[model samples]
Target: MEDAMQFAPSENPALATYSPEVRQQLFRFVLQLADTSLILGHRLSEWCGHGPILEQDLAMANIALDLLGETRSLYQYAAELEGQGRTEDDLAYLRSATEYRNPLLVEQPNGDFADTVVRQFLFDNFHYHFLKQLVNNADERLAAIAEKSLKEATYHLKWSSEWVIRLGDGTEESHRRVEKSIAELWRFSGELTIPTALEKELQTIGLIPEYADIQASMTAHAERVMEEASLVIPQQVFMLTGGKDGRHTEHLGYILTELQYMQRTYPGMTW
Candidate 1:
């Protein structure tokens, strides 16, 4: 059997037992989750020295580091599950833009302090629900990792939500900026709740929760936070989606170029 921290292919002959379509769906879903964490962490790392305040600078950088660490575990587990002789570094830094499975929200530029807060706010809420569901994922190791990660994600959501409230109610200028950021970013959020066909299958089989249930929990939590902050939720219904199907913005290429620079240049040199 695979150890708690290691997944050996032979142990899960179930990998071979499952249909090719099911295997592919599971692999793609894992890759998408890992890619989202990796990209978002990279984006947040860009704010290390540029946050609005010294305290916020430290806070954002800490969260960025935590996200990168999470990405490492996710990528490592993915590579092992795929058994393709690929390291986490190879899977992460070596992938082409079109191969990346991160959602569009994480790839969007961090425009300003308010923009960053709102972006984190939306994603943190989504992560909270996603991780909660994954805590009981049919795959044992994946479920264990998700259970551990839920703790870290919970703190992130709490801290970011506080900032959302503070920025939204702090001052006229702050309120206007955060409100605008929320409005601009709301369209990207619908995708988080819209499960793919594979997701539906998993949910029906008890591998995951229904998307509607997750969305309802998320909406209740989000509305409560917004209400406490005296902020109104944006009423946008139109949404854009494509990340799940391998479409990405041009910005990802540049980001990948930078992320992969050392690895591509140095090949196998390790410290």
Candidate 2:
């Protein structure tokens, strides 16, 4: 049982007294969480009209709705912290494709049921550990959010994990399909655990946990889940990075083009 909220500034006097750089770094990390949820929610929304079954179609939409709401709250708080007066809408829609910091795995197209499951499986596994780390943040507001969201993410991970088992241990075609999806997505996970300099500063100040510690826990969790599911981990050692640095895959560019079309077409458009 790791102390989730110990590092949150609102909960810890020492962390509340950290240097300005440390505080900003912690805020940036929070933005990454918000951005990730927003991007994934959007990706999931594509399933609303396209699911294989009516029940699955509605369920995916509900999940997307949940993610979008969570991301909205997270980014709204981030905007407030920045003091730039930017709204969550601004952060999500006004930014260009390159400005979005979501990992490539999330933005990648949902090829099939297998691809979607593998993508979500990877994301949920990573998020489970990320939320655990954030729960111990020195920033109380963020720590509290993490604590609440961790419960939701836990359910998401469980659902995806079960799907992995169902698909991986199914017929030979099912196994091969999921294995291929896993292999394709495996290379994109490197950026999830690699902390930037800003994150390092926050870690040193106790505003957030160290990336190395979270990575180790996340790796073990993923390995155990896959092992139980009778799946082999992809052996690819090469990994893609730079998404955190604002360099994104081309798929993101197209996604942004579609998502931002109405806003860009009518600059002051509002509900």
Candidate 3:
């Protein structure tokens, strides 16, 4: 809901030249990125004072802040492209669960500390590589955003990966917990690489990278990290879908309830 345009102008000359269809596709792609980070940040924020240790509590909170910051920037840009006078707040706080475009992986419940870490590890791995490729996107504004976000994504990946290794290589109980987390979350991860129709269009226009390449890189990195952590990568299975199309898991409704309560209760409220 924050105004991220303060950091950078929303205007992009290149975007102005796009045809209506391509412009809409770009808006959808940007919204997907924003929604993913916004939802994940909200999830991580729930662990603020609930982390297993004070250090971890603060770490997760900081990471959540980073994700939210990125979300604000993406939302700001997306709103500008829509050119309907919608602010970041309107796009974020007023949207229904079905209107959201975040993948299911980020919306799943953060079961326990280990579950949170495993989820973060998986998403961070994909995010890091995805942003890496996005940095070279033909859209200059998007590439700039990606260039800035990749730094934070790198740290997020490192932090989550370390926790995954620590827990997996720690006590037997810890290992069991993270292993379970992996199995439960792996099904949701496949959707990360399966580009939406909008994303495919962007890829064709060079506005986005090829999802197949991104998936391959993400898989290799994830497998290597799992091996180092002494954890087994679950076999590929049926991947969950529909989040990108605005269909979401039931968990998203609960998340939106809490997240939208303040805004709905006090319309136009700002810190």
State which candidate, 2 or 3, has the greater TM-score.
Answer: 3
> Which digits, one per residue and each the tens of the lDDT, describe model 3 over residues 24-70?
88888899999999999999999988999899999999889989988
* Deviation from native of the Cα of residue 43 in model 1, angstroms: 0.6
Q: What tens-digit string does per-residue lDDT give for candidate 2 at 1-271? A: 1211222224435444646665566557768777788888888998888998998787677767767767866776677566577876788779887777777778888889899888988888888888888887757777777887788788888878888998888889988999999888888887777777666776776777777887777888888878977898877568888777788888888888888888899986997
Error of 2 at 17 (Å): 5.5
Cα RMSDs, all models: 3.1, 4.5, 1.6
After superposing candidate 2 on the true structure, give the runs of residues whose Cα lies further than 4 Å from its correct spot. Answer: 1-20
Error of 1 at 180 (Å): 1.1
Where model 1 places Cα greater than 4 Å from the true spot, the runs are 1-17
Q: Which candidate is the best by TM-score?
A: 3
TM-score, cand. 2? 0.89
Q: Which is better, 1 or 2, measured by lDDT?
A: 1
Q: How high is each candidate's TM-score?
A: 0.91, 0.89, 0.96
Count backbone overlaps in model 1. 0
Model 3 CA lDDT for position 210:
89
lDDT of 1 by residue, 1-271 (tens): 0212444656544566656666666777778888998898899999988888899899988888777777776777777667679888789878899999888888888899888888888899999888898887777656766886788789899998998899887999988998889888888887777877767776676656677878888999899889877788878568877776678877788889988888899987676
